[model samples]
Target: MPQPTGPATAPRAPATASSPPSAPPPFPPQSGPPPQEALAPRAPVPPAVSEATRLLCVGVHHDRAFREAVLDELYVHEERFPAPSVGIDAGRVLSHAVRARNHEVGWAGGIVGLWLLGLIVSGGLLALALLGSVGLVVARWIRGSGSADTGVGLVRRAVAFYVRWLSRLYLVYLFFAVVLAALFLGGGTFSGGSGFGPGLSDPLGFARLAAFLTLLVLAGIVACVALRRGQFARVVSEELSPSRFPHAQSDPAETTAGPRLSHLRTRLRAEQHQPLVMYEEDWPFRGFGTPFHTWSLAIELRPRGEAAPVPLDNGEILRRIVPLVEALRVPSPRKDPAAAAAVIDRLRELRLDECVFLPADGLEWRNGAPYAPDAFAAHRAAALEEGGEARRHFLRIRVGGWDEELVVTVFVRVHTQGGMLMAEFAPHVLTPVRRGYRLAEREARRHRALSWPGHIAWALVHTPSSFGDSVRTLGGWLWGELRRAFAGYAGAPAEGPSAAVRELGTDEDLSLFQEMDLDRYLKTIQDRVAGGVRTALREAGWATDEFDQKIIHVANGGVYIDSAKDSAIGIGNDNKISHTPGGKGGGKK
Candidate 1:
């Protein structure tokens, strides 16, 4: 089995109010929380583990679809890239989810107890629903609503949950009705006997008393969930820390071991551990996630002053801009020379990788694929030296700021073929996770006594679907495990970004500050990349005026990329390079 892939740094407990010791980060988190998460009123957020737990808690506590997606990928297939953080892992999140589902499914089983209570009180048509629901639920669990797809199957399963919950609720009402009918009986509670001296002698009186008792129990639970705050989402996030759940330092399958789920750790790691930023086919770039902005400039390299033109290759151009882009990661020394913090003040998340992206079929899938650094380095060098449409080269600059809630990525590709120095500048942004996810943090800080009723009402509203959600969760899990054990799920159809938890709650558009930050990151990196192209031109005795003009045009937003389809823009000759998809690049100068 393949090992888990991600940051090698082991996870630690979050620094809470009780034990507030903090280790200095490689750089500061940011100036403040992201816009959506800004009003949460949380303490200074802990580093990787805290944010990671919150992410996990979202899947564990709130979203059932996310759980299915994560588990399906973990049990069935391999990952495309290494995890970005040590704490936010597929296996760890899946274990937390499994623990949560076990508890929910356990509670969902109480419907059977409700049915038995109804059977004892009254065995009418209602009692049959309570009894027959067990068989229906079991059948549905086995059949699994075609659990493989996310479309109609998900709706069908959710409907099943509501149906089961409703049947139990009906039985509760029947039990209440049967208990209230005991006013005319003589003694026995079931036989209408006067077993109790004071109670069940009048139907109205019994109804009032039963209503009061039920409300009391319901109110107490909802009040505790709302006021005490421990039952909220953020608490789950904190509880998932390595101190509470030791999976951070070990295999997660051990925490919630089961034969139902196979290859928990291997599939989570996905074989490659070097933190290669994985993307999706949302836009022009297949695996580069959504495209925020893209601009390319192709300028002919001419000898300056009739001098012989020196050779300039794509590797040289890419190599030149890489360190220039990486230099941004360094923090400037404060004015006070004596102040040596060894940490950044703001904008901490920075990473740069020079690598090749192979097509999905081109990935190495052998068991325990050895990490040969020298061999990988040579492969990257070859990609830079000889670029292809399928085997592409890139200098990826990723700025994961705002607790990794907002990420800005810049993919720089340079090509110096046929005397044309072509460069593509693409910038993409991952917006803050869904606003609903940040609710846990806010809920943790709340202590509203009056809001308990609202909380109760909210719980009541979602109660009907409890059966379907919980049962489907387990049903899907068991089915997946069986598939992994027998049919082998390694070759299941690929689900690109949907399985990615970080990308799950992200919005299409960036927030105000997030937009500004992304713009700054893209511009700074683009400047460095463009400068490298110019530097190579100067060294090769080539005229850089045409390239400089196009750079200005791109910076000023004077170029319209969307207007052209399957085309490359060129200057100097004032011609166009037509690129046909799955065909060759053809044009005349």
Candidate 2:
């Protein structure tokens, strides 16, 4: 079991002899508007507490200390990080709305068919037509011109909204449909022999039906009340949890328990001279066989009194780091360049999609500058006075192909206060709709090309193998895409570095093909980036203490350490790291 490094309660400051006592440090400055002057002021830090402890205490007020350490090492500033905006395309929403309307029409037609069957069985054709006509007219009006505003646009918006909450609506529809079916099956007025007359003989059946319908109506009214109170959306979001899509299953052996940074300060108290280390791995988007993975290692250096021989600029640091990173790239032989070349040729010949791995370039640096010191001027001044300087830099590499692009960003910062070096690696993969369609078309053609006997045999084997589940999954996937396309726009600035776009195939084009070797491609890229950084840092002699190292798993905007047995409830585990048993004592070997 992992152990705490210090006393459970906050530790007292160490006493110093000969030197005069210093005043306590002020709280860190915050950005944005100031609070109302009438609001009460914050309490002052205790004089006995050290400056470092004061900062750490404030930072870990809400979160675990280990979590804060991981975050700080990664240089993850929520204010500076560029998160992607969730916005939908208006045109796609309109198209999806039209498709949904058509589907509803087909459903109406099925109802008409059922009514025809009833007419043959019980002779209520006139009544059936009357009932069906009213439903059809109302549905048509809603899909057509029910909007007092921008008619069709309003209808489209309504359709999109309904689709977003389709899971809930589906339950209501099922209940109502079952009730209606029960009424029909119970041999009621639809049988045509019955009318509003004293000859009515099935009073009990009628009463049961009326009671069941009344209960259903009341249940629906309660559901509406909950929805009006905004409870439904909250519940759905919670049920969906971690992300919009479900996590893919993987080998259990692939996961391992490691140190969590949330307990860093406690460990630091035990071994003040030793550096703290944390690692995080992220598979940002998965479940469609995402090709890329990112891993970040954060090392927190102990504060040093002496300055470096010379101040290093971002360009010089990147120049030294690039070679180390590039050295980990997949070798030409392993990459099978010849096979990739052949695949490209075949794609061109067949008019199918192509995959092209652009020539890998050295690390490119951007946004390098001295960090703004206004927010934490006192802290900055103290670090500078002690011969340390703070700076930040962003490095990116773009790997582009015919239909896919994998972009990686390395955010590096030097913290003057702790003499810390913070590095973060973020990888994002883009797969356009055209690419997905092309893959689907390729699969269909492959199925068609199989021998008739073989195809029949394959279908026999495959049809029962989660066929219904697969169809529903695909439907859900398409629905999500359409809903996202219609989602409301955010006015925030666009996130992350921009990529150059190159048009390959038109949206109308598609071809039959097997899966691309994207996993290997992305893995190679990841290896190179991780390997290069480790090598560079080692050569610089900054990471000599191997025992203090940690690996973290970052996902869904949270950082976590790996362990043999799952420890926490809220943390994610897909990309966890392994550690030796009882390795938590300041990472001592």
Candidate 3:
């Protein structure tokens, strides 16, 4: 939720109630081209956090296996910015998934081994070679040939497309290899490579027989490996529903994936409650929602007439503002079950969180010793009262609407330094999660159906791609592990983390009404904040003339829509996303 407001750069004089201008052009219109900030560089997501999100997307979008659902939410491009984590525990989720991922990875390696074994056999080798070459050519024809117009056509996208078919082709190779082994079954004997119990004698035939046995063992392994993935999806889905959206405080002991995984989950949860250092270094708005729109205004704290300024800190400034901020509170649940629940749900979504971000390097560390009480107290002190350039505190308010599909979050930070009082308001919106990501929930809640033609057809079409997923997943996983190994070796491994999943699965652009709601929320909060600050300044006998002028301009991008305005680029109406609007009034947004 944000409004186009802040320190006004415009030179217009403040309007008096007795006489106001006829009209002023809308300063920043929603219909216009995307805001400049939209084009800014994406916040770098930590590897662990990103991987955890990908797994959830995988489970939700693709039910059969646990592989990253690449490029599924093509339009969810904007909301991918890493924000403060909401309800989910990143550490626990990742911990549980590690064993399942490793299981898949082991099978992936087995698949590679089977392919190599097939290469050593007589007729099997040539068939694989022919099919692989033909598969590449046919796949290109179906996928369409790559164009050199894009960079890394040969090494990147083109190769990636080529790689996608490798698992599928290998699957075919396994079948052909098995058939060849059967055909030569009579020609080999287990005891000797001679005509002992068959028609022909050949060591190659024996080799084929052993390879075929290995393939059978692998098939069983595939079945076992597929189990953990489903378990993960089920556990996650059960805990995180319409009410929770993304976060669920899952019990590690009860929802155990494995012994090692359970232990890890327990340890991680403990760390979340008590952390030794600032680990998520890259995430500044940690434990807060994604910051989308932010405006800051700095005003001189000097008194109007020469008088001593009252000593002010973050806590004191907040004391003057909290009363006004309390105007928007969750009302008591009304009667009428459905209406009451929806209203309460909407109100409940509007959450306010307080956290402090502090330094870690200088702090003493003793691996076996308990986390120092003094360090924790220091953090609490900074969050509640103290404010410095480094130890920054914030008031974070989040409103999750549309069954937690769309979220509007506003963050407020106030501090006084060097005779200047700076106040900042930043609003972040997380658009609705992709429809595909909700498929898991649908599949679970709905009644079982007879295997219909359409369902079968869909499966058949995706079969080849599905078989290929694990190989691709393995490659990516291995790369990440290798990178982490290197980073750890260099003593620069990423540590701190506060990451949310819903943002990663959101629509690229927000809907028209979503935009309107966002504007409304930001304006509402910003106005209240401005009023409280002005009141504080006045109570202290400071000049409020300049602040008032800037406030007016910031309120609506300095525009009176009815006024005669200079020619400017129009806000073209071109919202491409489709989303359902919710809750008309009474905080049912």
Candidate 4:
């Protein structure tokens, strides 16, 4: 209490001989209340600053690192879940079913024959013996010694081959037999001699017998041809009885070790609350069998700060992208003078306009006519209409050079919400085939022949391989056409052999062109176009990200994105990453 009266001031120390005297203490030194700096609620210190905002603000607009980070996140999330596997033993099951059905048919035929003959017991035994004999033959065919793996198998295969061919040859034999019978019988009848029986004893009866035998032979010939053609085999293969051939038994190992539905359900439930982005990447417009070398860059824009970007229209998007289109010229021909000259000569032969060549300087834009509002309304009737104000604009760019013509259709759809704009650049290049027209004509003829019942039958019997190949080719063509129609409606250029080239080229020319490595030339053009578009967007303050640049083979059907390696992320002109500097690599993000 006594010390508190003097505010606990420290006692002054005596000056030492070895030390200099200390300066006089300040009036408020070390006593009484604490100094103002200490006692005044020291100006509230600013809360500890964080770097989170800085990192987040590193937008993809100009930051390569940020773009890569975003892509990594997307790929990592996609790979987290495993894909389902589908297993089918179609070949094995179908083969067994066909054999069983054939046995059943044979048994049925034997029973019918016994009934017709009215010899129940004897005929039944004969039918059983016949069935046993056929089974024995089939067993022998299937039980060749494993020791003669190559030799015996080869001989058996050869026998099967010859048997099929012999069946077709028999058709020719039947035709000759019918002709000979007609000549001999008709000529003999006219000459007043019994055609094929005791001479002139009952001429009318003999003629009737000859006619009946001729009709019977013809029916047998038709039956033989149908049987040889594998029509029976096809039908048997398709209409298998489920009771006779149940689904393949599941592998015990798989049944025990495979992921359970519960696991998937739990995983899905855990992720349900998280955000997800789902979208498909389409193949660039290219002809069937042509290499897909194009890449695309997609940019997403949202309101910046507190201000929204001005909403763009179709016209504005076109104006912005046209310069990019012009910049994507084909590589100069000086690098390969010989190839260039050949291409030029081919184009000249086709009588294409000088402007309709590859390596073109610029495109000629054509604004497609707008659809009637009524038409638009009708189209939208079946689908959910976009709630935001929206407008679609179509622009077609025709650029030609280097024995090729490229049609690029740009579809720009603008939405007022967050000023969202979608620009789809679809470029299609049409190159002349040496004899495309002739090849097409040949294909048309082949297609017609295959469509005929007789030819199909012959093929099924004598050349199952050829029949299968033809069906696949025709089916593929039809599928490609359907895909083109749908994509074209969505602003992609139509694909296929060019009408002009198909009309003018010869078959030999087409064959030669088909053998050429058109992929390289097409790849070059694709790289340039993609690069130009990327550069244009970057310069316009727009961020470009190819998170959507998925790898797809149009000819093969569907997109292929490998989650393990993220292969689709960096695909380029070669459908893979380029090691060379300045080489195309996924359009530079």
Candidate 5:
């Protein structure tokens, strides 16, 4: 036999290429974490040694390309196959290549020429008539006097106009053909009388006309379909217009060299004597309107048996799935804390471990705390509400392994307008197929429920009093007490807004946590301040003799000042302090 191809060497030994330096031989797996060496990061391979991995490391982490790639793969895979299977490596390779080359499928004038020629050859005079009609429509509908045949911009606009006109023309032709055929056939009969009626002449002409009409209608339909396909091509072209069209396919045989899945599969295959399948699926976290940005996959680890297939139940399989989940999660500018936590819960329910894939940013916060995407979509608002404005996005993932197979799903949601994308994987380890789907229902639902009111409240309450935005700032002691009461969670406080109930204007003391202004902002500063001062005096700390409390209102700000010894005490002169700015109690105003 011809000598083996020298391990298909590419700088490093095949075993070392994929496996960690300290890990056991990936071919024959080790029990129990493969030692600490297996967990250790692999030495950096030179860019020339393996460009794919190098590019993947940089590309996926930097931009949304890898994230979108996974989503696109999952959606396509789900569409093509039912109950997803990643049985063939060729399928995954082909799908990946298709997505990779999606942007490059351009009309190089040759394709356009072919299409035009096809139109002429196929439609002949009818096609010419349609083109003439298109020209007329373009002239009538479009604004510019200049010919649209010159610049790319003009050409595009002209093409759009032409296509739209062609579509309408096709519809009209189809309608006339149908109506005419009905009138002739129904109103006349077999070349007698009125053809369709009893007094008509020959109907053969009508028949031929109908046939030609049918043919024309079909041609228009075909052209419209082709045009839509081109539009899809254009969308892909727009998405992948970046300068770098780098391929991110990781080699399976290389341990730490390429994508983690590739190496893990190689090692698992070496250890087991059975066939395997692996794939992924995505789950959305944000409300319906946002995109499904996070994903999880389930991998099947089945082994061959005489009676039925058996799956491996190794703990290491569980261990490896965690990293795979982590790898699927791509960083986006928009992120929501509660939604993210919900994603974690969903992943755990799916049995994919969450500890391995936790975001570097800590997830803990008070009830109404906002996070990342909130930071990115930042806005300035003038509303006198306690809560500041916030924007949210979501990402979720799910992964699992079953009987010689692996699966994963990633969902990505960005912004309030909500662009959602999902990635799913089928369960075949050898060549796990990836696909993607857009989350439409999820996208719509989020927009409806997102709380613009609550965001304004949070902003108003969170902003400093010096900003002259706090509604209760002038309410003095009463406002202070109320504000303090509201500061705690809605449930614990003795007096404050109640929780968010669906009904309008009823209960006042349930809990106001996430709900916007359940207890309402102070209605009038005069009444609130008078009430607050009385409450504060009842609570003591202020003596009329030693100090004086006076309310001062200027164009710059309103202040509660204790004017004693010619100095302001209770509230700050600069308007920053809420109460007792000079650290002394005040006399009543």
Candidate 6:
């Protein structure tokens, strides 16, 4: 929302660490009083300008932070130059009067608009004529009545006041014209008794209506022009008035306003150069809670030039762009439990884990089916007939909080060729569970980064239990490393570089991991492991001698890992390094 602007009568005093010295005394009285005091004295010093009153003159819109900053600046000025006891504080008094006068002008314009609207329709032209004449008479009275005596520069103020309202009247005229035109055009059927539309019958009536419409349009244009011209003139005159306060400078193009606006622009321009600040659109998406997306932004202060674009890091850019891949995304718009199963099954074939799945068959096998021990034996039996890569056959279920429940029924088909698979999952019907599954899938992949080779080969799928555990353990280690690293980086804050460490560790919210480059690093590690595993499998004679096959899985931000099951017995070489399933703490096999 735009900020409000106007005169502030009571501005809060600024808090200063230390108060300044007292103000100087006022000017000494002139020698001879005499001449019955040439003309009357100006109104006993105009009210002092409060901090708020000074700000009102700027007329610039300000957000909460901006407003506070401005107030602080104002307080600094006052502290540096306090009002003296002698000849009133001229600057303070003038600023106060200027703001007050501006406020009065605003009120006067409102009053004139009200009067014109309330009386114009009922009294017609007579009312306008009366009001105009009355206004002229008052103008004359104020000009002639306020003599050089009363000492109030009241005449200049009066003139300013008059023009302020006069401009408003022109505005009202423009409004009235628009309303009249709308009514004339919209009220097409004259009255209930009229047989045809108002355009029929007497041709002269139509001519008169056309001419009246044209006149109204022309009058509106003239009123608008006059308003613009008169407003500018008033603003210029107000600014020139010796009593005016120091506020912002007016826009160069805005002849209608005073320098107060200009001052405001100057201040804003100065502030924009102060420093660079980082802001988050919102908290990163929380799993299974209110869904949100995370992205990083950087803003630079004191820009080298007027048009320089802020530079963004690579990870930050990807944070915003990686969600478009279907391979990396989940099934969506599901309706029922059955639909959810279909989606889950299809996801499995594509290696996209839409939801958690537990094997319905024996626990020793993967996805409820044990791997065949010998390809040659199976081939001779021809028991496993080849099928299209897209066919999927997997038990599908929705994953819940550390639990599972049977909701829908579906058989997913999968076909594998050239180390890639095509799969599709379909259900008999749609249900709400399907919708929930779709949403979950989408949330999981919203920021999935699939730039790695493994990502291109297979989908990365995970069960809730394993995912939570991996996140917790990996986060701890990664953060610990970062903190240890930053401890030696120079020019760092005394408290140490902890934002990176803190953010990486203990962030259960998976969205953070996606938005960051941590996943890519982890994938790199997984890729190395898979490569080493494949080399070992090639040594065994059970699989192809070539190390080209890639493993597939549904991973957060889908990816691939070569399968060891099909190649375990293919290796025939003896030169190799001993290895164990676990790394860093395990012994060689």
Q: What is the lDDT of residue 441 in candidate 1?
A: 43
lDDT of 2 at 235: 19
Residue 453 CA displacement from its true place in model 4, Å: 26
Give the per-residue lDDT of model 4 (tens digit) for 1-589. 0111112234455555665666443342121222222212111111011111111111211122232332222111222211100011112211222232333344334333332232233223223223323333344445443434577777776665555455445545544554454345422333355354433334543443444444443343334333433333332222222111222133111123224323433342332211111101121111111112333333465333454445444334445555544433322346654443222211111110000001101212111211244543443332112322222223333322221211111222222234444433333223222232223333433544454576546543432122222233344434544654553333432121111111111011122332232333333334433454444445455544531242123223223322211122112324432121111111111
lDDT of each: 0.51, 0.29, 0.47, 0.29, 0.27, 0.28
The residue-by-residue lDDT of candidate 2 on 337-370, one tens digit each, is 4442222211111110111111111212111211
- Flag regions of model 5 displaced more than 4 Å: 1-155, 170-174, 185-209, 212-589
- Model 3 vs truth, CA RMSD: 14.8
Per-residue lDDT for 178-248 in model 3, tens only? 66765565465645645444332455655566555545544443443444334444544554343332233
| TM values, all candidates | 0.66, 0.27, 0.58, 0.29, 0.19, 0.16
Q: Give candidate 3 regions above 4 Å deviation.
A: 1-84, 106-198, 201-254, 257-260, 270-283, 286-290, 302-313, 332-342, 345-349, 363-377, 380-387, 402-405, 417-419, 430-436, 440-507, 558-589
Q: Please give the range of 10 consecutive residues that has the lowest summed lDDT in model 3.
A: 580-589
Model 4 clashing residue pairs (backbone): 357-400, 357-401, 357-402, 358-401, 358-402, 434-509, 434-510, 435-506, 435-509, 435-510
Cα deviation of 278 in candidate 3 (Å)?
2.6
Worst 10 residues of 5 by lDDT: 496-505
Q: Give the TM-score of candidate 2.
A: 0.27
Model 6 bad stretches (over 4 Å): 1-251, 254-257, 276-292, 295-589
For model 6, residues 220-314, the per-residue Cα lDDT tens digits are 33343334323433433354222343232332222333575345333322322111111111211101111111111112112223454344222
Residues 106-130, model 5: lDDT tens digits: 3212233333444454334234334
> Over all chains combined, what TM-score does candidate 6 have?
0.16
